[model samples]
Target: MAAQLVRAAKTESKGKPERLRFYYYTAGSGGAGPTILATSFLLLGEEVVAYNKGEKIKLKPYSGMLNIDFGKGIGKRDVYLLNLPEVRSAHDVLGIPTVSARFGTAPFFWNWGMSAMTNLLSPEFLKDRTKVQQLVQLFDPLVRAVDGIAGERVSMRVDLECTDGRHTLGLFSHRKLSISVGNATAAFALAILEGSTQPGVWFPEEPEGIAIEARELLLNRATEGTINFIMNKPPWMVETDPKELGLGIYVLQFRTQVVEITDLSGGFDLALKAADCSEVYSFEDIHENRKPPQ
Candidate 1:
């Protein structure tokens, strides 16, 4: 997918990529109701940006606070990726100026361990059951709330736009993507896709987040199947009223149409059906399965 986007940008766009963005929206259930916590960061030529309180805000490299709290307030907090290294060097190779990425659960990913340490350091931890639970959840909020935070419910999206505002390339996997090669299992979300380096076969959701170059190499390496080039258009939201609502009711209330432009390619006849993979979602239903054999 990365290789395809890079090819489109290089051939269709006139100048360098204007920006690069990455997003991870985890689905969850909480007190208010079922809550979906979405965390995203954008990479501009000179700075980083995040969406908070309905506006775009700038953030520093390692010091800025990118808010992940989405009002429902389950594990609401502002932490700078806990000084983690989501910022990668792939931009240099992608022709984008920078690749600054900060996820919504990053703080929790590293901070959960902090909770363990905090309890260990406190001599009274053995006697304080309430304190132990409180401190543990306080530092690692999602330990108990796992609906959307972990597993297949987590969805990811990537965008690459040209500096000229002429092209934008986007890829969205509405759930976790995992692949198995021999004995090793690779989950796309587990790896941050730091650099351009890979040499192997590409799975449907290619678990490795294997380098962009390796996927394109499938021409001679492994092209026994088909590739899908999804084009996002028409009514993106398909609203359905649950039977519990007495036949006519809308559960979701908000909608935003993503407007991006860029080059897109590939074929969409090969959709994988694996019970183990969390992400086997399709942006559109136009596939070979729906058509008569040629």
Candidate 2:
């Protein structure tokens, strides 16, 4: 399914409301196959994640106001989608509702690989300097905020195996989002979104994270999956410096366990696997005072 930005989310007094619509360009039969995919978006202080499968993926809501037809021709069918909170629990800490993904289901025959294509075309991955400059101009405010306070740039990276059967992984960024800030923040990356029954491990008793006082993390089984964001090296380690060369540099390195994807009537499910893709972010702290070499 081909995806494009339909509209931008408006900010609310509390935070901001995120709304996105993608269009699907279909072809061939509209049935069979249970291909699963996900999309992520950042809104206010939260992230929204949406997942969908065959014949149930919607290309309308994602179409937004922007429309395009690459002569691939569109089809009429059904679509499917699922909405989930990207940042599970951020109310207590941010004093605002976090962002979440919205989903729907329909039937259609689209490129199917559109999701991966969109990620590839995303400004972060595009090699075209003009396209990159346009993106920076469009997201100047947000980009500046992330770079200024968060100390890094925002990016989305996807890895998929179209030929071989393997689970797909999306590494939005290597910086650990603040376990405290919620939503994907350029600042305070998620060093370790982990959990353990052991004391001093820093966690709450909720399925996700607990809410109270200064805010303790609950970290349930599902939330435990968040650990996939962390790397083996120290979270704050200055592994490399790209600023000296006068370029914005960020790298996301991750390692993953092989999780073969199988399709059944019940849907695509697999053994939870891990891949190491941790990252390092280098940016000049605008707030730091400069000291000449002595």
Candidate 3:
């Protein structure tokens, strides 16, 4: 993706005397991944500008803030995680928003707020005071950080775990700090290919130059499948009750339309089905008899 961006920038700047400016607006885990890519482009002789929290800074080769060791095998490796103490200290002295594993401490509270309600109402976790205290300790820093905004002094620690599991991969780690490599890569690609005209900060999806064709191509490539780009249109234009769309799920049941494709093959379908006690299911089950319900 970085290579593609460099190529497009070079192509666009063929005759112009001024250098093409590349700005990478990154926060959270992007400070670890996208910063590296931007720094690589800088080393490759592309005029690149990198920013974190709207402050312009010099781009350095991937180091210091984050560290990784490639000596161990795939899921069994040690990563000297980010400097939490330094980060906390900076946030304390500079009055900047304290960064949580997620974007900011606000999300930690958001999750805790929802979880607290569930724990209070549900019998599963409410019975044990120790468990509730443990959960509180885990999130105390974030709460304190919020309180610190009002001139209160507080100390907090963030725990890091290294295990032989899917969590080893940063992108697929727990939701609190998970990063989507595909989305990030596509965002950079689109931003470069479809040069942004807007001046201030905006989401990749909000930009104008990225046409529907580019979006379709990117979505298909990233998802590795044909996409049905549904939009509000004719045919499926009936309105229904608001409760039909379940919580935490985004769905448009009215005025919906599907995009059609003419030439595509080797595509696959996935489905789920009910099984009986007599039926034997294998891990590699792909037979027509096991076909999923409509």
Candidate 4:
């Protein structure tokens, strides 16, 4: 399949003979490999892949999965340094809405299973807006940041977050123009095949002239690995949590320690003498073991 795509790409460029322009969506670990390959292609003068623009392709219907890996040494304090507030403001400036109506349903299903069904049927659940609002507050900023960076709507997002003792905190937001890191490689490959040779940053769905056959072929290849495409509804539509979506388990194994210390600057000499005494004590023991006073 890859051979066929390459041949077709070569044949299509028979007359143009220009570098292929490509655009990858995300830059996370998943996207890293493809991005490197695309960049290598450019360096070798084979093709050019940019993040600014490319031929928009229609992705098949599939459910998006958001994976969050949490365990030892992960903490909220660490996540806060990422500057989520700045991200949220940037998204707002870009006219991106963080949460969709379907967003509220993710947490209910993620943290609770059958209980979610029961809660959905409860009058209190229907009447209560605070829980859903709180969830929106937590997820909106995160989703915006992810989307902004990827240059495509991410159907699924995964990250580590601090978990409370009882409930695992998780949520999903609507994607406007973000792609998953998992899809980055495939997206770039598709762009190269579709003959995107333009410059500047671009979304995968932005360009035209992408053949349907080529689009389907590339989309299939793109989704083959750890990536998935959502054609119908978002992953949260099923009312499942990150764990249920095949996301790994969340475990907290990190602890912080606090130690108190007193300044000894004024008695530095005495402290040095004490240290010297300890060293001398060790030699004295050795000397005593060997011979008296010698």
TM-score of each: 0.38, 0.19, 0.21, 0.23
The root-mean-square deviation over C-alpha atoms between each candidate and the true structure, in angstroms, is 14.5, 23.5, 21.8, 24.0
lDDT of each: 0.34, 0.24, 0.28, 0.27
**lDDT tens readout by residue for model 4, 1-294:** 112222333344333111111111222212333333232222222111121122322211111222222221110111100111222321232222221110111222322332233334343442345543454455455544543444322233221111121111122222322243345566666667667434555433333333334555555555543323322221122222112112221111112211111223331211112212321112232222221132
Model 3 stretches astray by more than 4 angstroms = 1-113, 117-186, 193-209, 220-294
Q: Write the residue-wise lDDT of candidate 3 on 1-294 in tens digits.
A: 212222233344333111111111121222233333222222222111233443433332221222121111111121211112233322332222322221111223332343334334443443355554565556455544544343211111121111111001111121211133554466657645665334554333333434333654553444322111111111121122112123222222221222221212222322222232122222233222132222
What candidate 1 gets wrong by more than 4 Å, as runs, is 1-3, 28-86, 105-142, 145-152, 174-213, 216-294
Compose the digit string of candidate 2's lDDT tens values, residues 1-294: 001000011111132322222222222211111211212221111222332211122232222222221110121223222233322321222222322222222222132333333444542444354554454455445333433443321222222222122222222221222331254231213323332223343322232232222122221221232322311112112112112122222222212122222222232221222243322211222112111122
- 289 in model 4: Cα distance from truth in Å? 80
> What tens-digit string does per-residue lDDT give for candidate 1 at 1-294?
444655677776687655554543333322112122111111111234443322444554324445432212122233332112222334434445544454343324533443334334443442355554454445345534553344432323345555675434333322222211111222332232434334454443333445444544432222221121232211122211111123222122112222221112332222322333222222243222121223
Give the number of the best model, judged by lDDT: 1
Backbone collision count in every prediction?
Answer: 7, 54, 0, 25
